[model samples]
Target: MKHFLSINSCSSQELLELLELSIDLKKLYKSNKRVLCLAGKSLAMIFEKPSLRTRMSFQVAMTNLGGASVYVKPEDVGGIGKREPLKDMARILSGYVDGIMVRTFAHETATGLAEYASVPVINALTDWSHPCQAMADIMTAKEHFGKIEGLKFAFIGDGNNVARSLAFGCAKLGMRIEIASPAGYELDKGSIERANAIKPGTVVQSSDPIQAVKDADLIYTDTWVSMGQEEEKAKRINDFQGFQVNMDMLKAAASHVRVMHCLPAYRGYEITDEVCECENSIIFLEAENRLHFQRALLKKLMSSN
Candidate 1:
């Protein structure tokens, strides 16, 4: 079965194809056309973490593609790893649904679901990676910049799943990606290795945000403290003191640099309100692309299988 657990799970060529489909899908949607590619199909969405974009996008994506979706709330499932075996739940869901999309705190839970599910399983969001978010991000960048290759993408903040996924996707597509994070918060070793393998010397890890965004065409930042890290919020806020992407940081980037944040942003923390609301920010467009990109992803993953 095919699964989208990480950006590296798909080859460079496959990622390009998915991006192309996403662009085509966006065009189609804007033209007021209806696509019934997944007619009579259904997707089972399992969410362990509450979200606005992830949930709404996937549900709307299914609806746009003529597929119905059933949302399984976090409490309804009794937590996959504890109440019931992940493998057992995966098997059961696979029998009834055409596909499964899961958002969880643990990366292993997402992987475990894919292991036993007969149908394709997509990692909606996990601690280790957010592949769907990465796809939308790439689609947004490509739409704005006219191309993906050779663009300098810079990520500033904790090297969490969003950073890892964005770096992995950019590197795979031949774009230069640099990440600036505080000490001990670098991107995952596995993700770094995979990106390096795809495009040698394409990923740069730095502690200096100024140097990272020196020539960047795109600047990305996410919340410093993610779900399950609420206890360490104070320390994280202290550690990420100078990592904020404000107007000063934009001055160091390219003249046409675009700022992005995977929302629920701590306005004054990881980024400033002035920067997010500025004319150069494509944050809202990036968020909206999730719906279109996931629509293409669902069709690609389910229609083929």
Candidate 2:
């Protein structure tokens, strides 16, 4: 656990331990208990993509832990890996910060940073995976359902970063995940194979949203148009026509099914306003859990003990 790069990089025990820590932190936070585990630490956050949750969650998590964060944009550093080598930047930043967190377009940038830096590097989000978001998501599901293993999880949308990470998380935790996506938007073969390798028969893919949600314990979705894909917005909207998670999709799922969405949700697009505000939706709770999970993660990565 040197670097929180991807869910696939973590063992089941590590994932569960982080979740347990997150739960404990959440309880302490609600009770107004002061947690200063990383009191003297500093985190450096580098961003190549625009963000809301990723930026706020890591910054607030550091604040809650009695630590501080420094936000770095591409222009601030003369463009990451363009003006200077990634290894050189990684080494320089590691000398100043206790940890590094990056939200970038290429997955290699995060991994490359981890390779050269002595401090832990966390993948805030990449075009390929969103491990932190998945951690918070699983925490929300566990808090709601009382457990995660053996749960039937269904993901309906582009088989993008969120869906990929969720599949890996569910597979590692012994939950079965089914992803429903339109043709050409399905989860990549390598990702599916890796997830199934973690837990045999853990990931199932399909084209029909209704079939994927059948008797599912949790239904998840993300925006069809992700950051950097603005050019394809119109085509994505048309291609994902029947893929929206609405009342009709919920009606097909189990009676106890809960809904989750990684935020910055597009109302009337990936999900409807009705479903976003429904009783079954834990979207807001899921968002809040991001802070808790990242707090636990920072403490684990930066604390002396």
Candidate 3:
């Protein structure tokens, strides 16, 4: 069995195939294709942290494909490696569910689940990466722009999980990405190095958002602080003060620029309502793609040999 815990798990061909499948499924949906495609398959999702988008999107994707979900909140799932060992739980759950997904604090946790489980383990989120979100973002790019490579994408704001995944994935598909973040809030150095190793000249990280945005076709931004970083919210807000993506920043990019956000945004903080509501704002479309992307991913990972 194969798993999709990270973008690196599959070759460039497999990645492209998944994107093509998303496109096909989307066209089918537009033609009123109904009923779940993966009716009998089940995905056991375990979230150590709470979420709105990940949970809802995955559940809906499963239901839309003729499948069902069994959500295991942190407590319900033994709080992850507490009530029993991770491997033990993995051994047990793999037998019951067709696949497993865990949104935990460490990226290693997802890897551990995949290591122990006999079934595929998807990474809904791990502190270090968001492979699924990257899929949707890329799918949107393919749907709108018709290609991923050679397009310049500037990610302005916090360089967190989404940034890491996007950096790796864009590199895999031959896209040039610039990450502009505050000095202390920059993307993981490891992710940058890994992306460079995957494809030379694929990723560049810096602290200058405006410079990164210049000549870029796509402008992407995320929240100043992540879900678990609430304790440092005040500090992050001050640190990311000039990093906000408003109209001024959008106009700094190319005339054909399109805006994207993973959503659950802060109205006037990292992004202003004016920008998210703009004609170029494809943020909602990106959000909606989360479901289609997951459907395609589930279809691939759950497919039996």
Candidate 4:
């Protein structure tokens, strides 16, 4: 069984293939082809954290592929990898499900599950990486731009998992990313250094959003405060104080620039509603691509015959 735990788990060529696959799937759906490629196959989704998009999109994706997904809450199973040990849980889940997806706080928890499970284990969302969302975002970029390389994108806000994956994706594809964050909120030095090492000239770090986005093609940002960091929310708000993607900042980029966000957006915080619903915003299209990307992902993981 193959697993998708991080962006680095896939090569640049494979990432492009996923983008193409997602486009193909969207076309197929429009042509009245509801693919059930995984018919009779079952997947178990273990959630150590809460979600809206991750849960809905994956479940719907499995169903669209003619498969079913069973949701497993922490309390339902001795609190996931703790009550009976991670390896033991993996061994148990592998028996009944064709695949497993876990959303949790730790990256190692997903890696541990992948290590022990005979079935494919997916990282739905972890504190350290968000490969699936990046996959969808890149697909959006491909559809919107009609090309991937040579695109100058900028990510402005907290350097969370989303930003890390986006930076990796851009670097791997020979594109440039200008990331701007408050002093201490920059992308994990480790993740940035690794992406830079792989594709040296493609990643740039900045402290000013305007400078980061100078003539950028795709402008991006994420919520100022991430999940499980409620205690730091107030502090983050104060620190990220003039950083929202409003009209003034949008005009700072190129005339053809498009804005994107992985939603559940805090309106006045990370971005303004004016930008979210702007005609230039492909944000909704990006959200829709999540379904197609998961369809392609499931087809890839379960078609390992």
- Specify the highest-lDDT model's number: 2
As for lDDT, the candidate ahead, 1 or 3, is 1
Highest TM-score against the true fold, candidate: 2
TM-scores for candidates 1 onward, in order: 0.97, 0.99, 0.96, 0.97
lDDT scores for all predictions?
Answer: 0.90, 0.93, 0.87, 0.88
Clashing pairs in 3: 36-64, 36-65, 36-66, 37-65, 39-66
Worst 10 contiguous positions by lDDT, candidate 3: 296-305
Model 3 CA deviation exceeding 4 Å by range: 35-37
Cα lDDT tens digits for candidate 4, 16-60: 877788899889988989877899999998998888888898999
Provide the lDDT at 178 for model 4: 86
Candidate 1 vs candidate 2: which has greater TM-score? Answer: 2
| lDDT, residue 200, candidate 1 | 89
Q: What is the lDDT of residue 136 in candidate 4?
A: 93
For residue 234, give model 3's deviation from the true position in Å: 0.8
> Residue by residue across 89-185, what tens digits does model 2's lDDT show?
9999999999999999999999999999999999999999999999999999999999998988899999999989999998999898899999999
TM-score of 2: 0.99
Residue 129, candidate 3: how far off, in angstroms? 0.7
- Lowest summed lDDT across 10 adjacent residues in model 1 is found at 1-10
